[model samples]
Target: MSDKLAILGGKPVRDEFLPYGKQCIDEEDIESVVKVLKGDYLTTGPNVREFEEKVAQYVGAKYAVAVSNGTAALHAACFAAGIQEGDEVITTPITFAASANCVLYQGAKPVFADIDPKTYNIDVKDIERKITDKTKAIIPVDFTGQAVDLDKIMELADRYNLTVIEDAAHALGTEYKGKKIGSIAHMTEFSFHPVKHITTGEGGIVTTNDEELYKKLSLFRTHGITRDKELLVNKEQGSWYYEQLDLGYNYRITDIQCALGTSQLEKIQKFIDRRRELVRKYNEQLSDIDGVITPYEEVYSNSSWHLYIIQLELEKFKAGRKEIFEALKAENIGVNVHYVPVYYHPYYQKLGYKKGLCPNAEKLYECMITLPLFPKMNDRDLDDVVKAVNKVLSYYRK
Candidate 1:
């Protein structure tokens, strides 16, 4: 059968194409975007402030600064946290490249730590082992929406006088213990990409409770140009007068994106609840599979369920992970891998980063596969995914 025909056939079995993750847009989101489009300020306006305020309030953070993308948010957070040249920033290897690259962008070095095999987040013990006199910060990523062990990390950070910059791009609604991720970290970054819990086309936000850090991030999100007379050493009495303090980029987010984000934020609770339901179903369905290990959540952590990841046990299956991935794809299931270890990339390798530095992350890199899990998925779509997954796994087992 043709690929198109197979996809169409699967569509009937499913409500729609089961994207691994996606944005859930509604009438409110549309109306907000339309309102922004009709308004005079399309770039950096009142809606941006409104959205930032709402996010900060929701996360129990004192301030939030909207930026162009998650990467930009990370950059702003690192800068605001005072990362400087030759300083070492500890982070997990099993994350998006942006997590480590943000440290490099500040002329600092990124030091890799192993991840906790169960949670796939930066291991607090590994972080402590890697910390040195040059260590300046800990960039703990909430991988796959599971909150890292923040209590331990915060304790270590306090001991070392290091800052914590949370790569919470996958963990907007996730929590550690009773506190939210954004509020617990010294600085937290969130992505509003299509694949994230929310969507703003392409946007991110930096959240912080420290007033000084918040002010610094707010300035960095724009052009580091401030119109506030209080920040200026010499006040100029002109409406257009502004001071360019730090070298910054045009990382500002548009009002249109903020409007969309605000709309999406309104439904975040429902989105998170449905995702947990889907995860429960997946866990029940896949738990008995001999060669599969489902993602684990910590007792003290509340995951956002951004992506459902499972590891393939190569010993139990006749085929390799790649073959199983291909089989699922041929069955019209859109499965994908979460990431390769950041240090495995050419850029990091060129900088003398080596393998075996993070054994746990490297092991995960070989077996991890992200299954379709999103707020938009219905019962039919979920069932279709389960059926396809079972078919692939059965073949490999045989």
Candidate 2:
């Protein structure tokens, strides 16, 4: 590797460009999808139920409802929580817009909360401060795959009589206090996007121990329709009778996608292990480097390592995050930022959300950078990343 910075016209770190995240699809995964193709039913079939059961069992939850995507999962969870106009939901601003947009979808408002500076999870104290009588729910995101302070959030929910809808999109394999994230919250949501721990092609699911919530989520996944006789108003109808009891959307996940989900679920443990191993190497290589702050892990939680975000100590660096980001990209390092504060977007601004709402989260947004991480990456790939980061940061250090 070259000792000089690539942005300064020196030799680049690698001959090929590396991506920040990607799916690991193998022949077994292909075979699973092919089997689904040969089956009689392609959607709303046995594979969907089997994948849901596998996910629920893997996370120690009693029930799971599969949906079209993570956004749909959040929308379904919001519907199940009964959030509506004039209702408020508390959530951290340091997450994907969908974390808050789901609230908007239900004609409700999303109150912005700050984040824990170290772990980057939602701040419980801020969540409490943002709550009020109008606050009907809390959607705490497990940012960067670290579990939020579930114990504290659950306690607050109890104190305020608020529903807890955990956004576990980045935390499929994460655990809090030895309990899996999905099993701990009132309603936990998981995404199976290509970059996630597993891929359902484009799908999501919600898991809950409450049967009532399970029913509501299931109804919401479909068009609020039900065929069970016990819950139906007309008990005398024939076997073909089904009714649309409540207003819902078409958010069903296909049997084809579920087949891929079931196959991918089989290797979650292996995927998580490799991610943890890569993170350890990142910590070792980057820990001693100046002006770079490695991610912090709380003793009570084991993160799934969905993203490896590093914060730049701006005071120690001569350049800001954008210049540094470009420098690394010039070295063939695929660096990305996990999020921009949700309120900072123009759409939120037009919705009357202001900047400086969550100071800590805003500060973190200015310094954070997501580095390349996935199960398929090897030691040399990790080394190349370290070398590029060191080279860029060293050249820009004040």
Candidate 3:
């Protein structure tokens, strides 16, 4: 191992910090938000419907329901799918907690499934093995924006008479076998957080082709209230009348955020293109480096590249993940870990989940590091990230 330290003698790659992921906003995004600020309605208004329509058309889905945030979107989908007490939903453990927590929101059990180690996605066979009589749904997450094997998952869902709700928060522009992700699944959820492909400050939406599911999602998003005359039990109650059909939450998003989302959606293709370009550059630069393993992309799908993750060969390094992570941070590179297996969390453990549930996911979590990848990043930013990673690894190599 090298004796020199960047903190002591060598110059850092960058003077400023570079975050793992960030939103790209411009004049148009600002202008759109300003327009909404001056509009008639800020909460549930025309902009929300227009944004939903634009997203539906973009993803080739028939209907879209905008919600407060990604977690809300997942909860709405689970509720719409009729996930109740005693139901089991199989999903990958190598994802954000919200992916599994949504199942718990409906008083359903979330069954942890191991991931395909190479692709870092839920294993299809593992999903099949986890299914039982109580299984009512499968919530396959598109980890790091790579689309899950929807065909296989859907086949399993069909065989078991189960609903498939895709947690596609990381994948907005991703395509699988020449088809958009949102259009393929029974119901798909998207996030518009600052780190996601698009931003509405903090917002999410659920997309689907099923009309009944769409209706349920809409109702659930707004406290289960309905104003449509056709759906009302009491006819001729007057135009001012509304009714609460079922128990639901107020997961509604404001038009101000939706306006921003609509603007960001217009540039989504460009954003995705830039992210892909950066991933390609990172792959080319780091693939042959010792003790480093770049992300793997399956042939059947094109990833939106939400987060570019690298797996470290810990056996070949004297330093552990925490040391390397700190080294990168010392060089002004903002790196992160995508997740800690959902079942490993204290709350999940309290709910009867344990550490050994998904070995592959736990193993992956031990070695993986999320690097910076955003549309706003230039060649210099990419170079700095690559340089910092190389410096850390070389100094720590055994």
Candidate 4:
């Protein structure tokens, strides 16, 4: 590959653009979806239950409820946690907007908390500082698949009597203190978007050890309707009797998607292993590049490595992240930025959220760049990314 910067009209790294993330669908995944299509039920069937059980078992959680998507999963979790009007839920502003939006969905106020600059996860101390009499729960995101400080968060939750609804959208396979993320948090939500470790086309789930929460989550997913004889207020009416116990949305995921999810789950360990391998390649190759800082690995947890991000050292680079990002794009390296702080959005600003609320998160947003990472990428693809990054950064180095 030529060393010339592609953005400057020199030879590019590759002919095709490589996306930052993609789903790896195999024959088994296709077959599973086909099987569900041929079956009698397409939604609200045995496949959904089986998939939920598989997810719950894999994460060592007692129950798992599947929802329409990751955002729905967060909303369902918030509803299950009883986050209502006038309540406050604390969460890091560094994550995808859905993390905070879920709180808003419940008519609750989302309190923005700063993040730990090293791990990119919510700072537990900031979470503590944000707690108030109105604070009902904490929605801590395991940003970049790195586990948050669960022990400390749980201690604070216990002391404050706050519900911990962990937004584990980036941490399906992450483990903390030898326990899987879904099992450790009071309630953990996982996304199955194509970019995530697994794909259900577009789906998400919430795992919890509490049966009450499980029931609530199940109800919340399907318009709060339930046919359970024990909970029915009019059980003697008829066998077809069902009741909507509370206000909920139509967030039920289809059986076809769940079947695909189950098949994908069968190979999740392999997928996660490949992701970690790619992360290793990135770290080993980019370590000497003084213009960028690699992601920090936490000692107490094993990340599933959903996204490999590098923060540009602006002081050492002549150009900013935007210029470098465009340069990498020109090189056919599909780099992306994970997030803008949730409060930075116009809607949030209108809702009284200010820009300077979370300084650490805001700073991270300015420099971090997400590089291509997926299980199916070959060694050559990995090399192309590294080469493109080096060429772009080297050209921009002051």
Candidate 5:
């Protein structure tokens, strides 16, 4: 092992930088987008409906509503769940801020639940403790593409008469107890960001089996304006007549994006397979390394493998996390942290949240690093990442 760290003038493992995640775009994806561009309807057209139907069918849901982005999907789900002022929604803290911010959008309070240290999902016991009469919904996130304890969450929701909206942004192909993530939740939301399993530039969709929630999602996406004759309260003056039924935003996604989503969805299984393979390789190679904790996969879950995060035993390392992170970056490995606890941010701090709210999430954030694990990575890339990690850890060993 080298005496000096990579950041301290030692030879680096890689000559080029490898980002933690990336989009896998193919010729077919480009061709689909081009086809949509050449067509007449660019926004809110047949392609959008087709993409929604395809997603709903793939996830075994009765309906899906495609929207502008993941944040909008959460917002729409909250709206459909009837989240309002003075309402409280429970969710995990170790997720993207959008998960909790979506509740704030509905003028509701986000009651953050602590995580299960082993699986890094929200602890059901903590969730149960946080529940109250004012709790209108529980928005459990499928963190790092692994399904949360959905059966337990659903049971709690049923007992308390609360809605469950699954924030499945990282779990496009994840499964729980043989059911797809989107199929089992009361309502599930998915993101089509570039870093996700599938890309549509930037888009989102909500899936549900309830017809009432489906109608509400559809209405919420298009400024609450519907021309459906049956939904109209007054007699229609003409075929072109439409009415605004509720206060909603214009969160409609373009058909161009939907076309790309449709094409990307065709290869989602292959993408997931590649990601899982990479994760397996990571586990096999990194498991024996001292002080390195590989992610835990629950028996009930088949994770989509959106991220491959490793937690370092901080007590065993001579260097701090920042030093290790910088050392890895110097080796041309684009490592990143998944998140800080949502309530630990400055905005949330100003809103009366403090640092020690979720101790497990805070502790996880301090030592975890996300490794490069995109579907586009090859054998050489994977080997290089492993080498860099090992080299860095060896150098910093206590």
Candidate 6:
């Protein structure tokens, strides 16, 4: 313990501070970026298409559209799904703002669904209660890498004729009932941020099998322009001629990012395997701690373990979650809260949403703490995290 503590200031236990999540770079990743940098096209090129095709194949979808980021992917998905003003999209409150903001982008209202207390994903039962004639879709977030109960959500979607666009930012490598996550939903969105299962610096993809939807997404990604001479209502009769089919933003991803993404995709399995191993170790080490509740995985789900979130057992803690969090930070273990209920934000609150709308999400928000878990962390780092957590728990546990 003394030597480990000395390593902290002597040089820093990590080459840099251990972030909760980060990109895993390797020799192949570097070479791929260099190749793209030296290539002819930088953006809207063949590599973009190749990356899309590879992702589509990997996720078992018919088409994949690369975009600037996950937010852009969600925006395109919402637009293609036909979300409009007065239309409502129900989604979990325990996700990044993009999950709900995408609906707002299309001028649709975002309805919040409370999460399952056990799985911390959207509660299907609660989602059913929020549905109405104006409800057009449900964006179920695969929170923290655990696959949402797509079967239940799909059943509801089938009953209501609502589209299902999965917010799979945290679930790039997750599986549900033996099927890959993107394949199980009508439309699936993936993120390639540094913290995600893979990295492209900042990139995302939309995957779907519906040809019409795929066409819409394709055009929506690049200023609504279509190179397809066939879709032109009036052709210039030249190969270079193209047309803007509708109002769309320039959400195209660069070749450099795609190159990195494609390279990162190759090591996705390794990243996921390592993350899963770390999660297992955390679960085992924290299970017996009186004030900590480890993450839960559904029997039918195989998670990518993008984040390892734990809930504080309020009954067992004397100082509450905030105090415990600060204590861990003081010990040099980076800890963070996953989210504040989306409705609790000022933007949503302005829209007539309130604190009590999703009680489960609010309750979870109070106790949720995201631990540092990444492929770069070694056993010593793991021990530091576990020990820090234990030290905090012992100090606060009643």
Taking the candidates one at a time, how many backbone clashes does each contain? 0, 0, 0, 0, 0, 0
lDDT of 1 at 63: 91
**Candidate 6: pairs in clash:** none
Better of 2 and 4 by lDDT: 2
The residue-by-residue lDDT of candidate 6 on 1-398, one tens digit each, is 33333213332333434568877899999999899888898887888888999999999999999999999999999999999999999999999999999999999999998889999999999999999999999999999989988899999999999999999999998989888888778899999989899888999999999999999998998899887977997777678788899999999999999988888888889888999999999989989888788998999999998899999888887887877776666676778898878888898889899889888888899988999988988988998788777766775667
- Per residue, candidate 2 scores C-alpha lDDT tens digits across 1-398 of 33777788888999899999999999999999999899898999999999999999999999999999999999999999999999999999999999999999999999998988988988898898888889999999999899988899999999999999999999998999998889888999999999999999999999999999999999987899999898899989999999999999999999999999999999999999999999999999999998889999999989999999999999998899999999999999999998989999999999999999989999999999999999999999999999999888888888
- TM-score, candidate number 6: 0.95
RMSD of each: 2.9, 1.1, 1.2, 1.0, 0.9, 2.6
Model 5 local distance difference test score? 0.93
lDDT winner between candidates 2 and 3: 2
Ten contiguous residues minimizing lDDT sum, candidate 6 = 3-12
Instruction: Estimate TM-scores for all models.
Output: 0.95, 0.98, 0.98, 0.98, 0.99, 0.95
Question: CA lDDT of 10 in candidate 4?
Answer: 88
Writing each residue's lDDT as its tens digit, candidate 4 over 48-147 gives 9999999999999999999999999999999999999999999988889999999998899999989888998889999989999999999998888999
Query: Which lDDT value does model 5 have at 216?
Result: 95
> What TM-score does prediction 1 earn?
0.95
Model 5: per-residue lDDT, tens digit, 191-215?
9999999999999999999999999
Give me candidate 3's TM-score against the actual structure.
Answer: 0.98
Candidate 2, which segments miss by more than 4 Å at Cα?
Answer: 1-4
> Which portions of model 3 show Cα errors greater than 4 Å?
1-3, 7-10
